[model samples]
Target: MSTVSRAPKRSLASRLPVVHQLQQSVGLQRGMLIAGLVVSGVFVLTAIFAPLIAPFGFAQRRDDAGIFGAQQPPSAEHLFGTTVGGYDVLSRVLWGAQTALFVIVVSVILSIFAGVLLGLVSGYFGGWLDRVLVVVCDAIYAFPSLLLAIVMSIVISGGQSSLVGGVFAAAISITVVFIPQYFRVIRAETVRIKAEAYVESAKVIGASSNRIMFRHVLRNATRTLPLIVTLNSSEAILTLAGLGFLGFGIEPTAAAEWGYDLNRALSDVTSGIWWTALYPGLAIVLVVLGITLVGESLNDLADPRLRGRRAVAQSAGVVAETSVVPGGSLTAGPGGLGGLEDGESFDEHGIETR
Candidate 1:
């Protein structure tokens, strides 16, 4: 009776979207996801352990050995060398990860709550309020996102703000820009889902409007959100970098920021000093590339048309199941199949013979 277990017992945590794909994927898709995961993991760990991992403070010009000379080339003492401001490049890079992480988290959270709520309400109700919201989102989308972010950042905090102020200035500005994107996508999803049979059935059952909206509608509406999240995370990083590069970022003494590092390195480029610009710019590229890879891989896997099934013959020794129905309980008797089918019978060996 136990010969064929029903897909084993996987915890809900283990069945999370990307992790499930990461576990099941094979070939090129698997390779891309692994690479992205490694890079993202490194970025996250560096952010979490910046103070412990870094050799010096982000704004520190001196250490036990004295002041780190400006624009020093790579050496044993400073692996990534020193910036023009006499701070260790490695330390700044590590600490910058923390700042980038903060922006991504804050921006994504704010945007998700505000956008999803508005979309849920607008889509569920669908009246003058819906039309007004749609028009407002369209108007917001009409302006360039970056320009809007810049204006928001300027209004919130000008040059050389404190760490929290600067991070929030950049994050909130990004939130405003992305709210519309999330709203449109979610609103459209909600509209389509509201008419689904399950939703209608829930309504018919006299379930509270709030319960129906949240329990049934919200769960299905957010399936596509993970894809949007990955894309927006990379954009959040870019927006933070842009803010710093344009001189609206945190003060160097207040915190490390990649865009500000790039801004400070511009003069060094003409001087043929490469380390200053290279590492920070490379950090941006690698982080963005990693997020983009994860997003693309998930999107491919999510689309049945793109991630076509592997035939049993092509799967080596593995036999993949297409249907999701599980085998019967032990109470259904020694055979795993629920019961006898029209032309199927269980032989002495307990196998279903047709």
Candidate 2:
């Protein structure tokens, strides 16, 4: 019996990381998750194949005398249209996915590294260091997200023509905004988890603080980070767009960026050049929506109450019977209501009769 019980426990421990236990936990949320995966997968593929699938180079212009002139409407020659800058809108849109994915990946990675490090230290050691870090994080968190991004943009790029600088500026700014959220979540969990018996046992066994903090505490505390990461990736795209809209985006000649295109298209609306803005805007909206749906579904998956409800719903066909054991406390049994002893009597109804 002991070996059998330990076998199940070991299997459960092995499966936690490898299996997505929450994938089928709920119907509506799982559907949203599937939809998000489909949308995100398409964008990811677009990013990977931007160079090959895009009909034109990101900044390719049509100086050749043909139907592919500057600002031409969508046609066979220019599938989406030609932009005011003579670039192919379809190619630019496709390439923009690559740019967006890069920014999101870089920002989220940097933020997670910094945030998790600070969170682990602050949470494990509750001294003046923790207080100072907490105060600083809160102060930064108070600033409006876009405003903070703008400040970081100017600091990093000086509104310069460097493509790499603009990308880093946007990524770092998003990182700053995201770090505090990760820090707070991780810190709280670490504080609670550090007091558990296993953690105490590690301390008692002469484990170094560093080992226990990293090996034990950090692992358990960061369980929710996947959800945060998905949500933050979506925000990073928006922040990158805002930076571009304000003219702090990547240089147009160096890369195709959705936000920069939208900025250039601001005046085109008056002249009825809707294609320039519409496609990029839709790209941003759909990507963000897809990411948000994935994040929300992940949140639902992480919730215990939802999981319990889902388990109950799944087992609805199996009736659970409450019975009184010999000790007189009510307990569950496979058979129907079982409070009766050997001599107990019942009428046509299930009620007991003296």
Which candidate number has the best lDDT?
1
**Which parts of model 1 are misplaced by more than 4 Å?**
1-14, 158-160, 311-354
For residues 116-187, what per-residue lDDT tens digits would candidate 2 score against the true structure? Answer: 999899999989999999999999899898998888877877766566776777788788888999889989
The estimated TM-scores of all candidates read 0.85, 0.84
> Per-residue lDDT of 175-260 in model 1, one digit per residue for the tens?
99999988998899899999999889988889998997788888989988998999899999998898889887777988999999
Q: Tell me the RMSD of model 2 versus the true structure.
A: 6.1
lDDT of each: 0.87, 0.84
Residue 47, candidate 2: how far off, in angstroms?
0.9
lDDT of prediction 2: 0.84
Residue clash pairs of candidate 1: none
